[model samples]
Target chain A: DAGITQSPRHKVTETGTPVTLRCHQTENHRYMYWYRQDPGHGLRLIHYSYGVKDTDKGEVSDGYSVSRSKTEDFLLTLESATSSQTSVYFCAIRTSDRSTDTQYFGPGTRLTVL
Target chain B: SQQGEEDPQALSIQEGENATMNCSYKTSINNLQWYRQNSGRGLVHLILIRSNEREKHSGRLRVTLDTSKKSSSLLITASRAADTASYFCATEPTGPGNTGKLIFGQGTTLQVKP
Candidate 1:
């Protein structure tokens, strides 16, 4: 729905390895966000971008970085992944209008670090 | 650090019963949103309430936003087994082009037994 897709529906990796997850949207929205969901903590924003070449860190952006080089793609990279980072990663997109628009979510990527 | 937080971290109920969950946020927001995640795979946007509005309804879902108290409540009437999932509340921060960028709260896991 809304043409949002996240790569690697599921992944298993070892600690200290770098991993990059990709989010692609066919809807051509102007805003994109990356978030992680874990037990108890709910969904925490990792990063978000308002437009291409513009990005900002979220509350839990310590070990994460993001890039949006184009309108349709936003990439989230985990530098030196840790076990604590194991969680479901989600991508969201929405139009630029501030007129009560709902954010669309992708099917999420489940990452497990051993 | 999350801007919103859900209470009753977990809730269990029977089919045909009503389910209620609460969410509280720290900062002022333009609007609030509710999402449902089935099996923690993906989050489906359910409903949204703006700061200026007090209550909104969609099908069997009802959402109430108390901007004064900085809290909100979601009620699902006559919930079915399919309603078993984790529910999250998200806030759209007030700013330029802040429509789709949502800050989420920890979720409440709801288990509806059939």
Candidate 2:
């Protein structure tokens, strides 16, 4: 998984509950991203962080928030879980030394909202 | 909105044959990358082709990009059963404030039967 790990690999939560997913990287890459994969929607970026305390929204940032307080950790929070937000979440880090931007992904976390 | 769209959502081929996948994007991009994901696993970067470069090769994989057409293609020679997986094309959009964010396609599932 390219030295990236996501906690709580599988979780089943009820509606309106708060959920936070953690993504930790050993590579200390500067760029981190959170993405969700669904059946038809493919992979949609939720949010991304360029550096510590610097974050920005992606195409599907609604109902989700992200924080990067440390260089190796990026957190994705769901304020209130909903059925629509149930999907497989993946975290990725971009390679800095490579000539072309290539991303390495972490093992995904599967979340089910009831 | 999705930035990239893949052709042939699902494909079935026999071992020793060749497999090809196509991706088209909506905007100008700095580079195009291909990634493969096995079932219940994280995606692994396959190959990356810059906008200036027309073709790239890595082992048994070949990638070609057409900036004018805003499209790219991935060809796998001598496919094997172990190569059965989902392949996705991601593009890093060109322009100011580019944080190396990637927009991924829906992906094409390849089923290589032995």
Candidate 3:
């Protein structure tokens, strides 16, 4: 609802295969984030980009990587997908002004690894 | 480890009744936020209460923060069937380079019976 969109809304891949989820935002926000949602864990941050070419790891970044080439695009990639990496992924963005702490989210991408 | 833990893993209420969800966090935070997720969709920002703020309101939602107890509560009045969703509490840790990185709770699933 925040002018955000995720590519391949749903994806299925075999174990050891590679998967990439894309997030695009039209709002020109400076901060973008990647997160995964699980039943008992709720949501955990995977990776985030504070600015183009600047990224950082999150709580669960072990198996995931992210790249932000431009202001509108952020990508999350799994080099070797595994059953443990199967989860619903979300992308969020916020303005850099720090006027408000609210983060807007994209529709999400559901990935299944066999 | 999750910074916040929500009480009453699930809640059910009549459409017209009020619903309250509580969240407790272990660390000091700069701000606490509430988000809602419907089924398999991404999270939607509901409201945010800063550490210095006691209470804030938006539409039918009211949030209160008690830094002394390191907890927060969200109250939704005049609930509707459409309000059925999972609510999560996230905290922005008070530290350096915290560019809106949030640690989330397990969430409370709310069902509003029509």
Q: Which candidate number has the best DockQ? A: 3
Candidate 2 clash figure, as a count: 0
iRMSD in angstroms, per model: 1.7, 0.8, 0.8
- The lDDT values for all models are 0.88, 0.94, 0.93
Off by over 4 Å in 3: A96-99
Q: Per-prediction TM-score, please?
A: 0.92, 0.98, 0.97
lDDT, candidate 3, equals 0.93
Displacement of the residue A2 alpha carbon in candidate 3, Å = 2.0
RMSD of each: 1.8, 0.8, 1.2
- C-alpha lDDT (0 to 100) for residue A48 of candidate 2: 98
lDDT of candidate 1 at residue A61, scale 0 to 100: 90
Candidate 1 chain B least-lDDT 10 residues: B94-103
Better of 2 and 3 by TM-score: 2
Worst 10 residues of 2 chain B by lDDT: B95-104
Label model 2 with its docking quality class.
high
Each candidate's B-chain TM-score, in sequence, is 0.95, 0.98, 0.98
Clashes of each: 0, 0, 0
Residue lDDT tens for model 1, A1-111: 689999989999999999999999998788888989877777888899988999998778999999998899999999899999999999988753544577888999999
DockQ of all candidate complexes: 0.70, 0.87, 0.90
